[model samples]
Target: MVRISSFGVGGKHKSTKFALYCVGLFGLALLVDLLWASSNSSPSIYQSIVSQENVVFPSFAQIKEEDKKKKDGIDKKRVLADNFADLDAPVLNWEKMANAPVPRLDGAAIQIKDQLFVFAGYGTIDYVHSHVDIYNFTDNTWGGRFDMPKEMAHSHLGMVTDGRYIYIVTGQYGPQCRGPTAQTFTLDTVTKKWRDLPPLPVPRYAPATQLWRGRLHVMGGSRENRHTPGTEHWSIAVKDGKALEKEWRSEIPIPRGGPHRACIVYNDRLYVIGGQEGDFMAKPGSPIFKCSRRNEIVFGDVYMLDDDMKWTSLPPMPKPDSHIEFAWAFVNKNSVVIVGGTTEKHPETKKMTLIGEIFHFEFDTQKWSVIGKLPYRVKTTLVGFWKGWLYFTSGQRDKGPEDPSPRKVLGETWRTKLEL
Candidate 1:
């Protein structure tokens, strides 16, 4: 039988055991050196990667805050505050004058010599004022008052004065979102007589009207439906409240059409500025045309018509504005100053907001800037420039500083010196 020793082996076995021990020691030393090197270099490597990428990793709290702001509909880009401080404009000191006899909205005003004539307007939801209220700037009091013609419109009328005569055209006759009338009339301030003129081919609400050259031009308002934008442009030749043309002439259509736009003729150029595309409409099949606010877009679009009779687009207002209509005046013979109006609705609440800033559009630069701010935000205010002062009266005013939504119909008149 072959016998194996319990403890003894050949010389080859001893050499193999020694070689295995040496290899195990070397592996242990290599592993320890690798771990030490990794520990020393890890922080520097991480910092180098961050610096090269220029990345800032937001904390969990910061991420949450950003998400909250987005959900609240707070756009950091859309600013609603008055920016008059940023502009180089004259300082305005506002003073209160005598209030009108009645509060009204959507009224037309024209200055004739020392007197300001305020025409028909909306008194309440169901009532409309057809009286002509006159204010005397010289006496700082409400002067003579007269009733408009029985057939004349109550609100949304386009009015422009030529010395002694005030032309009234196209408007909602009654109240509660009624359709507009095509009937046109002229009022002689001296005789206080109403004369009929050629009716508009198309009826419009709060159209832009101006006496340009020898013809009276009317453009851009809401249609008879009271919501659709009207783009038709019409003109009529007139001399002393009499139409020289048998029928109204059709001119080039405006690029964009809407109501409550500020239209003026300056330096023989006709300009239309700051209007809206949509408006409050009547409910379907309602007899009285119950007014309901609809989805609308107010804009700051500006257009000019020269002797070429072509419409030219100009720089828009600093922001989208509407409801100005008569709330503009010529200042310094080089710029037009527009007062309180409406702007974009709140992003989250979707409620309409009123404007308080006075907008200045420079004819020379063809630019717009915020010159001053009103005492309170309002819409549909009547504006006039007389004797180096800017006068504004009668409109719907905002609720308060916190709430920009219109609340009260105001008849108070206010004015500020035109320093610039």
Candidate 2:
């Protein structure tokens, strides 16, 4: 019959079709939900790639502005940290060495190997040291004293060394602000004997002196009056501790001239640094040349003489400094370290002030920095550098931290490792 089997097969086919339709509707609903969620929240993979391509970056001007702000912040910090009185500066660890055999001031010191030779200086208002005091760096003691030539200047002398020979140039021959002597001499350290050189054509007091290009060059000192600034520069050919020329040759005058300046030859170039425009002069017609302070201007001018024998003005020190004729050394072969010296007078008190800050000058950058302070303020401190150590022997000390006036001459020796 039309049969129950055929009807059962058609019914099964109809149920299968309905199930397929229901599955299609569910899949469409899930796909639509995913599309709506992506549009409202997290991007789909295709949408993310398109967004990345359209992303904006900062402009060059904006980047520059940010960099400038950073630099300004750094500059402000540097300024805040530059105070000289700040305790965070480098520690010198200045250990006391042997006191000098005698107190002195305005002396010249030179180091040869393990020995430090202290030359003529002012011992007192009336007395001047006529002996050379030799300090043995190895033993940390003074030894092997010898008398300077009776004719040699006893104070305010300019001294420089080349090998075993020490050249002593023009200076005040006696105490009490006496006139300078034209006489110049050389002493052989090996023989401990002195030889006379042709006298400086013009006598100078505490002139800047150095050996450069086989010539002994001298410049910038007080004239005969002891107060007039001398700008004359002279040189004489020298070889083997002897003069090659019979007379001193004239060179270009220094722009400014005075005593107590430091001169050095580095990289075949000559440099002159720090001095005063005037000095104490002898009262007119006074016997023994009684000394009295005159109007003076401490200066920090720096000059460099090049291979072409032309001088170029260089950047000056932060403050005026003078009386540092021998208070300097070449450190690390790239910079100069100047020790204690005299600075500008106090603003209100009008009294002289001593410099305690260690001045560092860089040859490469032609810049200056206050590296450290001395144990106490001082002036005319004889300085020497040996085997990474800095040594200062004699000087005039300040009365106190607040009092800028000089108290007394000192013979104390101090040493510290060369940290900078």
Give RMSD (Å) of candidate 2 vs. truth: 20.3
lDDT of 1 by residue, 105-216 (tens): 8888998877889987888888899899998888788968999888888999998989998899989989899878899999889999989998999889999999999999
Residue-level lDDT of model 2, residues 1-420, one tens digit each, is: 555787788989999999999999998797667555544543333244445448433344644554575566644334433322222246578999999999998878888888899987888889899999998878889988899988888878888889889989989988898888999999999899999999999888999999998899999899988999999999998887798989999999998999899998888899999899888889888988999878788989999999778899999977678999899988787899998788766544556778888889998899998888788889999988888888999989998876657889999999998877
Which pairs, if any, clash in model 2?
A: none
C-alpha RMSD values across all candidates: 11.3, 20.3
The positional error of residue 284 in candidate 2, measured at the CA in angstroms, is 2.0
Q: Determine which window of 10 residues in candidate 2 has minimal summed lDDT.
A: 80-89
* Full-model lDDT, candidate 2: 0.84
Off by over 4 Å in 1: 1-91
Cα deviation of 17, candidate 2, in Å:
99
